[model samples]
Target chain A: MSLLSNSAVEKNMDLAPAPLKKEKVKMKKGLQLFLIALPFLILVFVFSYLPLYGWSYAFFNFRPGIPLSQSEFVGFQWFKSIISNPTQTAEVMRVMKNTLAISALGVITSVLPVTFAIFLTEIKASWYKRIVQVLTTLPNFISWVLVYSVAFAIFSTNNGLLNHVLTDLGIIDTGVNYLASDNHTWLSMCMWNVWKTLGWSAIMYLAAITNIDPELYEAAKVDGAGRFRRIWHITVPGLMSTYFVLLLLQIANFINNGMEQYYVFQNAINKDHIEVLDLYVYNIGMLGTNFSFATAISMLKSIVSVFLLFFANKMSKILRGESII
Target chain B: MAESILIKKKTKKEKENSRSTKGEIVFNFFNMAFFALITFICIFPFYYLFVNTISNNDLSSRGMVIFLPKGIHFTNYLQVLRLEGLGRAAIISLSRTLIGTILTVFGCALLGFIFTQKQMWGRKFWYRFVVITMYFNAGIIPWFIIMMNLKLTNNFLAYILPAVIQPFFVILVKTYIESIPAAIQESAELDGAGTMTVFFKIIMPLSKPILATITVFAAVNQWNSFIDTLFLMTDSKLYTLQFVLYRYMNQLSSLANIIRGSQGGSSISASIANMQTPTSVRMTVSMIIITPIILVYPIFQRFFVKGIIMGAVKG
Candidate 1:
């Protein structure tokens, strides 16, 4: 009876979906998936992969309506010319400095406000939290153009609100032309950046904080830890991973000091402080019609940013023992 | 459960205990005051904008408008609407945003469905392809060139086509889809349902939460997009709301020039004394531009909150 039972079990196992049937199923599934994916692959290749070929134009004298064969392929010529021209080089460097300064300030101001917002959410007042949430997010939906116009109205030299208030309060003898001064432009831009982004950035941190295990907070309280201590120990540490990831992402975009705000804000007076790489590209490529030089400059920015992103990723992995990439 | 009762009793005890601690009382007072102050500053700008929008144009020009409007003048709003190109531009912007949102949400959903299937061949390669595009784009020049070559310039398609299938949204949707249990899919497959039916009938219904999220995101992005219109839409009729606002501001500056010139030799400065095209007009214009979005936001605010949280937490 035992021998018969063993033989029957062996036979059942052999009859159960043979290896060849399994292989066929796997192959069919693979083919079905490929068929579904083929359309997106083609779309991406045409739109995304094809444009990569034009990156070579940075080294050439690129012209509209000229075939690749007809266009002059002067290797590294435009790059060398841009570096050699003192005016062009100075403009690039100045914009780079401004971009860094504004972006750094944006990052600093944004982090503090968002952190403060997350802390405020812990307070017992639901109405206060609700109102703060609404106000912070309201500015984000407003267009940058409108924000600039508002700034213009409020900061105009002769009849601005700030000036009127200051003069009325006897804080100043004359109304200062806040927008006209180069020193104030960068600061104003930083404030605008913070205004636009603070609430939105805080949302992510707040979400992350909510996900923290309640047990940790309870344990901290049981150990006689106050609100600040609990926040410093439990909340901040719980948020460290998210903070690092977001920080790395922000650092990766360090060169992209906003284009629209700077473009709209640019005037004869505040041009020095407001000009950034994006505005520089728009001026040279689109406005000036020097496509080749602009491409070269953009290529340089891209290369540097890619390197920085990779380096930051590596450093993050080392520090957190986790890879965001 | 025990902890809750203990915490309640402890809170009562702590309230009695804190009656003796002046330092604690002072600290709590300052904490509450500080938060209240921060909240006020955060909210004051929007209040200022709203008051400026409704206040008298002359009063706004004189910088006398402060916390509240002296008189409500809807005339500035009427003026903005009557501006030469405002109405047409608003319609164009609305239609484009609507169409773009629909197309983007659909395309992203389809792409996400394809990506989430584990049985797909070269899935890794395809996923990486999408992610690479998300990270690196050829910037604006090449994109503009492609649109021109495609004969998309001056067409509404120029605004909608390039943005219709963003890879990041696809990846987000795909991740959400991946979180769905595979067992459910297996049962549907065993019931002899085709891939399309399974996707449409099963996956989509289950993915409504994420679908709601991406829809709001796509809508907001399309509403805010102005650069594409500026670059691609050379025709005045094709201008979006943002582009229209931009032109209005430019026109204001030019009008300021003309008014100043026409009032030549006047003791009263033309730019200052005109009072017709004051800061209030700009504020009114802004309010008009954002009115639709603000009204629509609350409707989708819940979905937006959930979606944003999901994407951030998962990523």
Candidate 2:
């Protein structure tokens, strides 16, 4: 027993030096990886975080050519102008109304994609389903510029196809300016959005459907449930969690109706109802050249969006017992 | 008892055949028709544009070419392609897509792999630092200001550099790498492979699927982006095809004038010149811009679906 203990003690004494050496080698390797990772970190810092420093421009009357240090410090004066001044207040309110109205329409119509997905799975013919999916999803791949061009070709006053058909049918004496008309601009925009994203968003729900247990369908079938009942009880219940999660995300992004779509579609006539917050910022910043005021508005938007995201996260945690983030 | 059980089974079968089959048939017909209509709506615009651009411009401009081509000619595409600065813009767009995609894929793959290593210094903190950027943006003005301050205005690097470290792609790649069996990496380490060596030799090959996914994403984004060009490129040389198409759409008269100016030297007849209407020019330009997407998107589409599934599952 003493000999065996001595042998074990000797083995430990010999191996005690090895881990320290391995630690040194491991530390060196980590340093090498850190060196390699440093450039990407710097790139992220420059592009992502570095812009946060420019948010300070809101406090200054920043000019294009002049340095911020030389610009006058306004100290929330631009933010004050958004409320304290009547004309500015009206403009902000109008922009907010446009933004909120468009977003609300978006949220309300969000269920259509879910419905589309449910019905899409009901199609028995696989080839037809694939074709529908491929074609419907194609528009999402193209840029908004191309979509606008498509809109133009189909709706232009002089050479629109809709007008050509309508005139041939004697539906009207003249062509309606569908693209430029301010009437139902919100609804039309929503329709255009639905046309673009319905298939793409349905893909998420479809994926979620695949995750549902096939055994549930089997059990429901054994219980003599009808096809519609099975879909209602099994598939829909399975998809609600995904739907609610995506809906929460949509709500979190309530204010960020992206600029590209609205930017390309907006014109002099439709600008009143079509301009959302992001587009408004771009217009004032780039076209109006109100950099300081634009900065202030966008700063507020970013803060509100982040707060909304956290609020949604909290809601998700409280209700679903999961952290979305 | 056996006879009564047999009768009950027959009745249930009859009920299924008599009632459910008819209702399901009707439901299926409408469902198929509805989807067929949607498919047609989705496909018809591209067909309309193609027909218009290829048709005789006089008839097309008069709204005569609705469902089909009237006088087939490719002159609008020819003339639009011959426009000044278009060839350069195409080259610029192509180069940006290639280089930017490669850079982004490499950056994402490397960062993702390193982040999975337990030995990575401050791996959790660094990963969070990168991933958190996905949630909040500093807004457009500040971003534009920073780009200008960095001298990215009128510079091509403006497109390539800012896109390299997309936090969303990084997270996607990190999740994917985590799913790869760590035993393989450990085996590579046992073979005396260094970090860079192991990454190049083993991890990259194993990661082709996810990397392919990100490649499609990065390439599509690079090809479709025009807002960046609109903001940063005051220089005409750096304009992408999409942005140039946008310019033509907004300024149809000037575009028509330019086409006429370009075609004056050709011995074409007055009728041919008349065929190059502003509307035709715009439609042709739009077609040209979308052709690549139309051709490539279907081939790489499954990768995108895969990416969406990955994101959904991880979330």
Candidate 3:
């Protein structure tokens, strides 16, 4: 009878806290946690989600210093203007062409950092490697304004060192306005981007290389493979996943060639060629006072970018069975 | 016989490894020279700017100060230091960097810690809500309009507040904190420690490496950002050092006033006037803007490396 009573008490102890009291405690903890997180949620709402509401401005003739509600609502008029008007369409087409061209160039050259990483690892001296890495990564830290300053100091038409040296060497008779010239604008921009990002981008591949199993190299050596063979067989394949992931990300970000680089690099002469979608949006919105239209173009851009990101994630999952986000 | 053949093959491989082939030696020579040249290219521009700024103005403007300083003088730097509104802009930049970095690091750390709590309401939903923002950006116009609506335009808080809770940094901090053992927090909680107490007292003290990483990224971004000022601030009092330098770089008219003001007002020497050319002044100002970054970079660089690796793993 005592054993039976003890078993009954044990069952009561187990089952009693499983429903109401446990739920109350769980809810109390959740409430405390929610309170802790509420402020951050509010911040994210303001900065990120809030701007999304501003996408509504694309449909309105938004005037500065005027309340949005007081403004006249134009239903898809700005978006329709982009499609219906000839000159506007032509300008946008040009901007789109430039954007695709620049992004395509970057995609083609994305192999460079992988090559840089492989070669960088081949160097015997670690100190020399570290110094090269540090110095090459330096440009990534400085602002594009400073980069432009360096570009201007080196390539300015009048007092540029390029012209000065070229003329002195009889390579050219006078200074050429390289900065202002429209020739190879996209290529030059891509080259500048490569210069800025090569070392910085290589860091990821380097990290991947360290993650490669040392046993692979040992087995390759045991099999009488040479250094280049080892790199080709072991290291390159090991880094493939990392490279593909980065490439997928770049594809997702294809249109977001940020405005800053192109903005600082652009000049009156190269405006036709150098103006990308982001820069064009900035030019129209801020420089030309066409806020509604810029907002419209950007709304489309954001939609496309989100779509591309999901597409990329889909591809990542299909190919690698893993997702980036 | 098979074992002997394997031994022979191993020795041959060992020999090949000990002595690189002739082709590889040639390739290595070129590779080293090529990378060395690249290193030179990376550093030469700054060095050129430096030599030009310090050299005689006539020579630098004439493109004579190529490799080294021809006439060494601190007059250009002195003139730049005395430029109108320079000190005020420097102060604004410094304050923003300090305040922006601190707020962002703290916000990211705290939010990151909060998200890791299993009891947090709507944990998965909220995490996705924040992380999804990283993939798409509201275009500059919308962003600008929002800031305007928020009355952040031309306000100092515009710099500090928008950046306080960077989503990417939040993700980094969250990932780092997740890697830490959860048992420690459980123990502390058993002792009646609150969430904030666990975060501040236990989690934070253990997460210094990641905190440092976030600090470097935040500080550099704040110091280098000029687009916000370019779009939002019309007030010269709110101009940052980088923005001012940008104006001086792009608009010669804006720079002319400062150069003329410096040369015309003071009882300066003839040589000092010769040293304050437009190119010299521009280069000097660029130097001024970049010096702080270069100063702090070496110390914070390892943290960034760790940060990048962490990001790579998470990605």
Candidate 4:
């Protein structure tokens, strides 16, 4: 069982409690622990579950400060609109297409981290390796807003360095507006993600590399394997298992292409190519202020996500011999 | 360092087992060239921004300050520092990161301690209560409405209180707490110490690594956060440095306003007008925004690496 959850770890323990002798004392101790945990329980209920109660707004015609009883309860109307209304269904199709495309790119590049960890293992210079790893991983901590600044500083059409360089070299008389054009949105965003996360993603693979019994390398050396042969035979095989397990987890989260990066990069010109499902929900809810419609869309997304998670968990158990959750 | 040396010595032995081919030299050279290019790709943007931020506005604005800074000047930085409400925003960001990290860490650790008591009543049920939130949420609209109902919109408490009940951190702390010898807490109880006393006097001291790690995580999250402020802090007075930097980057009018508001007498306003645009100033402000995170990064990096590894590093 993973330590990421207490309930899972507790469930892993099969020991049965001693009964009968000190029942009253055990009850008192239980009450004490329960008292201490009450505040946390209440906090979770208020912040986490309370919004769950507000999900009822998807059924009712919710307005600010109005009682649900007073509002019109339209059962499954919004949910039905998801499939019935032509424009809404088309919008959903577009967002789903974008989400699946972006997520596919992300899953495909997940292999690159394993490539990175292997390359890192081969580097002979400790200082240089450390420098490269440090520089690459540092971007992971930076916020998207700050990242957008860096992107803008180098890529912005007006007074941008890239434009200046291309124009000066006579490659083009007029500057190309890369950011404003929707032509290469998917590829550009994927590359940006790879740049930002390359080192960060490789970290778990590095950890797995450290766990590779060094004796395997010694054994391979005894068998006359060269560097390339050893990396191919031993390191790749070991790392691929971890990568596939992680990929299974990603498959479960297929729809959750986070909205922040797209939100920052989005504009009138690029929004058509970049808007994914999560961003669509956010825009419709937060920007457009259609609370009920947005909630219905998200409720559907969440339900699908839960089912996907369950299927992935079952697949992981079959493949890896355990469930993640 | 040791790993590299060990692997290198192994390579030497392995080479003796099989003759080294002449083609290997060319392959190694190309491999080295490939890595160098990648390293350039990773670090060049930030370095270019640094150079541009320091170069003279005339040179930078025309995009002539590419490879290095020329006619270095601090005028842009000075103007950014003098921007209206920059000082106040810095204060808000600093206090929120500090207090928010402290409260969230202690609160999570405390709740974590309780859950680890093994004998706790309905422990599994209560644990799931927190854990289940990780899987499901009420979506953004309902959350925003709830935040409004709590009357926390524009309140500083909105930032601190919402983060204080992090179930993920609670689970992390609980995992560490469970590893501590039950004998220590048992003996403390034998000596008639209460739960709080045992937690503070015994468990807290022993859990330093986890506490420090959680603190760094929470502090960085708080410092980097502008989403909460964006949704809730409509009041200009509550803006943090992140929010300010975000505005300066996104909106051209906001950049113009920063210069006009920081008017610093007629001479500064005259210089600002003469400058034509604040593109370099935007770069300077963004540089200022990110400098603190980059500076303290190395100190907290080890903890972050450990956290990432434990969290499975799924990007």
- List lDDT for all candidates, in order: 0.74, 0.89, 0.88, 0.80
Candidate 1 total steric clashes? 0
- Per-residue alpha-carbon lDDT of model 3 for A1-325, expressed as tens digits? 4554555556556667579887887788888988887887888888888898889999999876687899999999999988899999999999999999999999999999999889988888899899999988888999998999889998888888899999999999989989999999999999999888888999899888888999999999888788889999999999999999999999999999998889999989999999999999999999898889999999999999999999999999999999987
lDDT of 4 by residue, A87-193 (tens): 98998998898899999999999999899888877776777777777777888877777778888887888888899999889998987777788987988888888
Interface RMSD, prediction 3: 6.5
Q: Which residue pairs collide, candidate 3? A: none
CAPRI-style docking class of model 3 based on DockQ: medium
Better of 2 and 3 by DockQ: 2
Estimate candidate 3's RMSD in Å. 4.9
| Collision count for each candidate, in order | 0, 0, 0, 0
Q: How many angstroms is residue A57 displaced in model 4 relative to the true structure, after the best TM-score fit?
A: 1.2
Candidate 1 chain B: 10-residue stretch with minimal lDDT = B266-275
lDDT of model 3, residue B277 = 64
Tens digits of per-residue lDDT for model 4, B164-210? 87877887788888888676676567557888899899999999888
Q: TM-score of chain A for each candidate?
A: 0.83, 0.93, 0.91, 0.89
DockQ of each: 0.29, 0.54, 0.49, 0.39
* Candidate 3 residue-wise lDDT, B1-315, digit = tens: 999999999999778666777767888888888889988998899989888888888888888898878868877777787788887899999999999999899988998998898887898898888887777778788888889889998899999988988888989999999998776776666557888899999999999999999999999999999889988999999999988888887888767878788777576564743656667778998998888888888787788899999888887
Weakest lDDT window of 10 consecutive positions for candidate 2 chain B = B266-275
